[model samples]
Target: MELTFLVYDVIIQVYAMLIRVSSLFNPKARLWVNGRKGWRQSLKNKVPAGGVDIWMHCASLGEFEQGRPVLEALRSLYPEKCILLTFFSPSGYTVRKDYPIVNHVCYLPLDSRKNARIFLQTIKPKLVIFVKYEFWFHFIREISKQQIPLLLISALFRPGQLFFRSYGKVFKQSLLSYNRIFVQDKNSLDLLKNTGIEECVIAGDTRFDRVLTVMEQSKEIRAIDTFLQGKSAWVAGSTWPPDEQVIRGCSDLISKWIIAPHEIKEDHLLYIEKLFGEKTVRYSILKDAPEKFTDKTILLIDNVGMLSSLYRYGQAAYIGGGFGSGIHNILEAGVYGIPVVFGPKFQKFKEAKDLIYLQGAFSITLENELKDVIVRLGNDLFSKSAGDICAHYVHEHAGATEKIIRFIQEKRFLTN
Candidate 1:
């Protein structure tokens, strides 16, 4: 076991070194390497001596969004404790590095004994919270050794994961280091219980709360209204090339289509413009002249941060990324009381399944199937029924944030 641990440590080091070397050419890798430069000292400067440090670590943007509801609740419930947020990926840190509630946001030091020791000693957090599936052995071991309360929130588990395999004893042992684990479903709870690990609670997914918050705080975009021109539109959000192909096929049936592609590179924008030539107009171009957008039938969203709010303007939505891995946030569209449609690769998502069961969302395998579903949902009566189902489903699944917060208060994990 000791030899196995040493091998794992060396492998982690090698991976980090490779990423650093790749930083010279790869822009994303460069961001990862450059973001960590002098991070330790930067963290030291922000965190004061003897202050009550409450640390939360997330893997990336998705994990950060999942953990946001809990973090915000903690901030409101315990105001005195300084909140320190860390991310393992550059995507998460770069998007939320300037978050107002967090006192400091920095990249997590690589998982090594020396790095862990230095980080734990410098930050000295009373409680450490990991969002989703971040299970760093060295960090967990160090937190256990220092007697700091380590908790994981919004976790999900499956039978096929390595932790359940025959040679996964070490990985299973890592799970024991967490003081408590809050899962998102009963299946995850059962999975943990079957492994003889009983310190877990099914607190539901915090993203339901997150999407509700998004719905409440959504900004009204005037240009979207002009583009709609009182016509019900179909929104295709976080779309990739494959998703674009499907949308292009059935776009003639849908009067107004909002294309919010995942990648907004020049090549992608040009492709979209050519695909719907003379019918498409960029979002940035509509800022000065909102009236000019009324004539255009396709509103191309060539920027980030607007996709979430833009869902509200659509009567039906198609969430992208299903042709690749799983799907993007279906709940983002579902929360706005709209029927959602996606590709065949959505079985992994619990919300997608639930929404489908509720008859609020549909999955299509081909362009013809997409067109059929869209035509069916285009009706006034059918669309209202589906929209109502979505609204009820979103409202029913809220309050996971309160459950986790109540547990923290009962355990008295806060300090002045």
Candidate 2:
């Protein structure tokens, strides 16, 4: 264990150094490095002394959404407790730093023994919750040492993950630090139990509850409505260049298109405009001059924080990122009862796999496959059937948030 800790420390140091170097060229990395600067002082100033804090850490914006339902529930249940939310990635922190629910939001410093100890000492949280795949050894160990109630929520475990491997004893031992692990699926529970770590339960995914809430709270975007003009469009969300290439090839099949690319930088926006030609109009421009874009068929969303709501404006949706790593959130669109299409690399996401099996979603590699799926979804009967599957799937998976909250109350993790 000592040797493993030494190796882990070396790896963490190397990773920190890499991030520092990468900050020179990478915008995200720059934000990451800069966010941690004077983190101790920042915590001291923001987090009040002697108040009970419930700390939740998310790796990125996605995990934040997954844990949001529980956070909101906790807020309603225990309004007196301070909610300190931390993000490991700038992608999460930059977007949600001003999130209204949490009392404070800040960047989690790099996972070093010293940083973890100092951070825990400063906050002195009564409960610590880690969303999804965050398993920082030092942070978990420090929290456990302090005997703070630590919970891992909306967690998923795959057979190929490090925790199940022979060399993963050190990593596996970290799981014991958590007071309870609320997993997203039964497979995760089974895997943990098989490994002799029994403090876990299948609480489904809180994102299901989140999407449903979002759907209920969603308001109309006048520009999107004007662009579609009663014509049903297909929304391509979080698209990469590869996803765009495929969409471009099948452009003729799609009547009205709404594309929300993953990166909305000037270069990427210009690239999308060029790729889609003159027919493409930016959402910002369309909002100001809706009449000028009356003839434009492709509406490009060159922004963030709107993709989830934008899914409602489409008859079908294509979630991107599958061609590169994996697909972005399909549930956001699926909850809207739309047939979702994505690239072939979706093995890691259990929701994607479930949707595909239920015929609610389609995974395609080639442009022709995309065209075919688009055409198939154009059929009202087929589209409705597939769409029903998606909506039902989302609704069925709801209440994970409630389950997690019930457990916390039952276990007395948080006092009233």
Candidate 3:
């Protein structure tokens, strides 16, 4: 066991060194390295010395979204306690560093034994919650050693993950350190149980709850409403170049498109403009002069944080990132009661599989497949039916947040 920990510590140090080297040229890597500078003093200066603090850590923006509902719930329930939200990736912290619900938000320092011990001693967190797949060894060990109540929420596990492998005993021991694990599905629970890890329960997914909340509280985007002008359009969100290429090919079938690319840098935006040609106008420009782009067929979303609300204006939606790692968030669109389309690489997402089986979503590999799906969705009755299914599926899986909060209350994790 000591040998395993030694090797793990070495790997962590090497990884940190690599990031420090990469920071010279890579902007994201630079942000990662810079964010942790003077993290110890930052925590000491910001976090009060005597109050009870609840710490929640997220790996990135996606995991932060999954954990947002619970964070807000805790804030409302325990207004007296201070909340400290930490992010491992700059993508999450940079965007949500000013999130109003939590008392403080900062980057989580690298997981070394000394860093972990100092962090825990500084914050003296009453409870620790890690969202999804974050299982830092030193942090988990320190939390366990301090007898802090640690919970893992909205977690998913697969047969091929390290925890189930032969050489993963050290990683598996980290799982044992969590006091309670709330998973997103039965498969994850089953996988943990098969390995004799019993402190787990199936709590569905809190993302569904989060999306539903977004939909209910969604504000009207006047620009989108003006752009659509009561006409039906398709929303393509977090789209990549490959996804855009497919969408471009199916342009003849769909009349209007609102495309939000994953990377909105100058080069990628220029590429998208070239692909879509003269009929495209950026949302930023269009909003400034809505009358000028009335005839444009493609409205490019050149900003972030609006994709979730944009789905309400479309007859159907296309979620991207499938042609690369996996699909982006389909629930964001599905919650709007719209038929969703994506590429063929969506097997990892349980919501994608469920929606596909229910005919609320479609997976396509080529232009012809997308064209066919779009044509089928053009039928008002069929579109309505599929939309209904998508919305119903999201609604049915909506209570993961409630379940988690109930457990926390019952266990008195927050009580003195």
1-416 in candidate 2: lDDT tens per residue? 99998999999999999999999999889999999999999899998897346999999999999999999999999987889999999999999999988899999998889999999999989889999999999999999899999999999989999889999999999999888999988888999999999889989999999999999999998877777889878999999999999999988777799999999999999999999899999998899868678789899988788999999988999999999988999999999998999999999899899989989999999999998898888899999999999999999999999988888899887774
lDDT of 3 by residue, 278-382 (tens): 989999899977867779999999998899999998899999998999999999999999999999999999999999999999999999999999999999999
Write candidate 1's Cα lDDT for 146-218 as tens digits. Answer: 9898889999998999899998888898888888899998999999999989889988889999999999999
Q: How accurate locally, in lDDT, is each candidate?
A: 0.89, 0.92, 0.93
Superposed Cα deviation of residue 37, candidate 3 (Å): 0.9
Clashing pairs in 2: none
User: What is the Å distance of residue 62 in model 3 from its true position?
Assistant: 0.2
State each candidate's clash count.
Answer: 0, 0, 0
**Stretches of model 2 off by over 4 angstroms after superposition:** none
The C-alpha local distance difference test score for the whole of candidate 1 amounts to: 0.89
Clashing pairs in model 1? none
